[model samples]
Target: MTALQRIEQGSALQQTDDADLVARIDMLNAIGIALSSENDMPHLLERILIGAKQITRADAGTLYTINDQQKLNFEIVQTTSLGIKRGGSSARPVQLEPISLYRGNGSPNNKLVVTYCALNNKTVNLPDVYKENDTGFDFSGPRLFDKKMNYRTRSMLCVPMINHDGKTIGVIQLINKKSINGPVAFDDDDIHLLQSLASQAAIALTNKRLIDDLKALFDSFIKTIAASIDETSAHTGEHCRRVPYLTLALADAASRDQKCMKDFILNKQQRYNLEVASWLHDCGKLATPIHIVDKSTKLETVFDRIELIDTRFEVLKRDANIARLEALLEAGHDKDRIELIEKQYREEIKQLTDQRDTIRQCNIGAESMPPELKERIKQIAARTWRNCDDELVPFFSEDEINNLLIPYGTLNADERKIINDHIVVTNKMLASMQFPDEMASVPEYAGGHHERMDGKGYPLGLTREQMSVPARVMAIADVFEALTSWDRPYKKAKKLSEALAILGKMKQRNHIDPDLFDLFIRDKVYLPYAREFMDPELIDIDEPSEIPGYPFDMP
Candidate 1:
């Protein structure tokens, strides 16, 4: 051949090399971006191995991450020739045991190639494992695997993944560099490309780990606050914990409802946010007074004031006995007069006993106080009794009268206001926090649980139109949990049938979301929750049709 022709041929070869180098660089850039963007650990690890194999044209690859125990854990394993895939997002799990960094004798286990690469922060490129006798690393495990799979064990490359902090985080092992002709060795270019991929993978893995650790810490902190709120009241101690489970369950059910909730769906992040919001829903109850929270009766404060009223009744009986004795002394044993005085004394004692019993019953608050009962309380309070100072005072205090006259539940207007203020505090507390963008709606979701659809709710009277679906879902969960919780002091836990009946009424009155309530009943979301958290006897509903407000034709 002519010298000029030879020079032209060499120039053409050099140009081809330059073009290939550019293509490989472009591929590396794309792979780096892909690795950094992945948030899921398993998928990221899998992608790292797959990307490595693609860049090096390898037949198989395995990715190993260093666990907290200083051991190499097989995160991803794939072999194209064998069509074997395990770990990561694969259904098949890696059954291989972890490679310990240290042996039983407390010495670094550098006998294996992957571990040696990780410990020394070096790369080992074996042209052929079968031919290499001076490498000083054990290939027995690969040999055994190859023997079992009926495959040749040749051409190995192991690279240590070193992060920005100059610490080795994992190892990547590639097998059998493949060409069009056959399996070949991993050359210098292959080593450099694998090293670059390993560096990016290391950073991605480390960032994910940091973010996960932070997330774990944040979740624990939120739960700790919830648990502290529960600790404030024995009667409602489980309220904070149970609401989250019920909220998530109902939310999931709503997501599946195609009829009414066709547009309602919670993505993974949104669902996570809802779960977090549910956990923090009642965090403000942490500031509520324990006395008011555990108030079991109308006249309850620090303790039951009914016992004090009992003392007063005893005082009145003593006064009546004194009067009866004085009258008998004046009559001087006159039979008719003595009989009349004794009869008068007995009637007075009976009336006072009746009045005392009435007061005791009123102190035990009910769902509603009868007007006649209130009048009765007032009448009894009008009667005067001598105090320790000998001054005449009404039988019942004004404060006690007001407490006994509470129309519903144990809390009076002022006490109820105090209780309602917790939602406001919850909103403020959550608003003050700088949550991530995905959880920005947590404050609204958590605080709006008490809101009514008719714009009559407290803290913020958000109408149904103004509230989000998650908020409404949380409201239903809150009420249902309260209704079925067995730990309440004043009222017994209602059976599932009764709770559903009441919830149905609530839906009709626009107190809760109608669609979500229907979905809750239609899907039987309450059944699983009831079975898990409620007493088995409380689940007494025989049929859905028996429940009040249940639409018989509901799809």
Candidate 2:
């Protein structure tokens, strides 16, 4: 019989005589719900193909999704009679060439059965492919398979999986519907059932692809922000990349800790969220001024103001020389008096030179500056010097004096506040965003990294009890990265031993999370990280036993 005649007969049989029709309808509804609930792409595609085969009792089927090149890309293929499965979750991959939906000249490719279904957005039922010759599609693929497998090319059903927008996204093809007797033509009842299932599959696939695209876009956005922040300082850029690695590594280690298994272990979503938080922790630094961040010396602003102070010292030397010359000219008639005046002038110039050297030394930042030295800065500031207006003024301005008197680090109090305010800005920026439920803790974890265990840290003085484990994980990562980092403007990278010692001290003083620090040492997370990212010379062979407060005996 012709393909059309067979379809008409199947439709008549479907309406009047099928006792199992109600059961099939219920099965179709259940399959649709199952397909809709599947979120995994490979599993979903596999389920779609499997569902169509079971409903039609087909011996074989192939699921194909359209690619950007307008080709029918085989996503899943299964053959029950041959025990063949490829693609989707199968160990074997689909090696078949994608069927083109458009030829080189861009005309519709209607010669292939799958392409024909996708192009026309309609189902094709062939009762017997070997006997049919009137259909516009080529059956060479199935004919070749039959020849190779010693199988017969018989009944077929090809349905277009169309999305809600009425666009064909893919095609579902079933071959050789099997019955108790042998291969039989897929009837209109089977055709209608497969089409309904294909429709649900298309919507599910579309929604999944859309969600995947959005996730990809969101990841790119985060990376772009990180790159932008990194571009602001060549020194800080490496920190942005390395800290995330360390954060995730430490987190993974913590997750494996048997003592705190319940508290520390992370699910896949939680791990992802922690990783995202680590990458974004320093995003607030984007708001901090580059000059302050790169300030290598105490007197630095746009440029070091120390040079301006040096010019004033030179002016004082010149004034002293003029006075000495004037005295020499006046005392020319008195030799002994002239000698005394010259000696006094030389001594006065020597004092000014000493003071100038002291100020220059003070300009360099150190771990600590003494009170005595700070008082001398005030003394130096009081020394009189003539301005362009000829009015005498203090040798150093109030702001310059304050910068020079900074007891620790390059930044003065106001500049330090500006730098610290980045955390505040970071909190605000992340808090304002609406994250998915899986990532809702991103703001909290990222914002609390700077907070100390003893409530001594900035932006918010959140104590250990208030902070989450992930937040504490970030805090340790941030501290360690900064300590061993060679990219800072003012300080050299600390050796592994030195960095760990400082961290140990911080733990002893309640400056960081002690339990996490112990795990960091016991787990040996630092060694591998240091080998990868630290300068070779800085990677020392200090044992965890030697690190103070590391609790080497802890189980």
Clashing residue pairs in candidate 1 are: none
Worst 10 residues of 1 by lDDT: 546-555
The TM-score that candidate 1 achieves is 0.97
Model 2 residue 126 lDDT score:
95
Clashes of each: 0, 0
lDDT of 1 at 124: 93
Off by over 4 Å in 2: 1-19, 147-153, 331-354, 370-372, 542-551
Best TM-score goes to which candidate? 1
Which 10-residue window in model 2 sums to the lowest lDDT?
A: 546-555
Scored by Cα lDDT, where does model 2 land?
0.88
How many times do residue backbones clash in model 1? 0
Off by over 4 Å in 1: 1-4, 549-552
lDDT of 1 at 244: 97
Task: Give one digit per residue, the lDDT tens place, for model 1 in 91-176.
Answer: 99999899999999899999999999999999999989988888788889989999999998789999999988899999999999
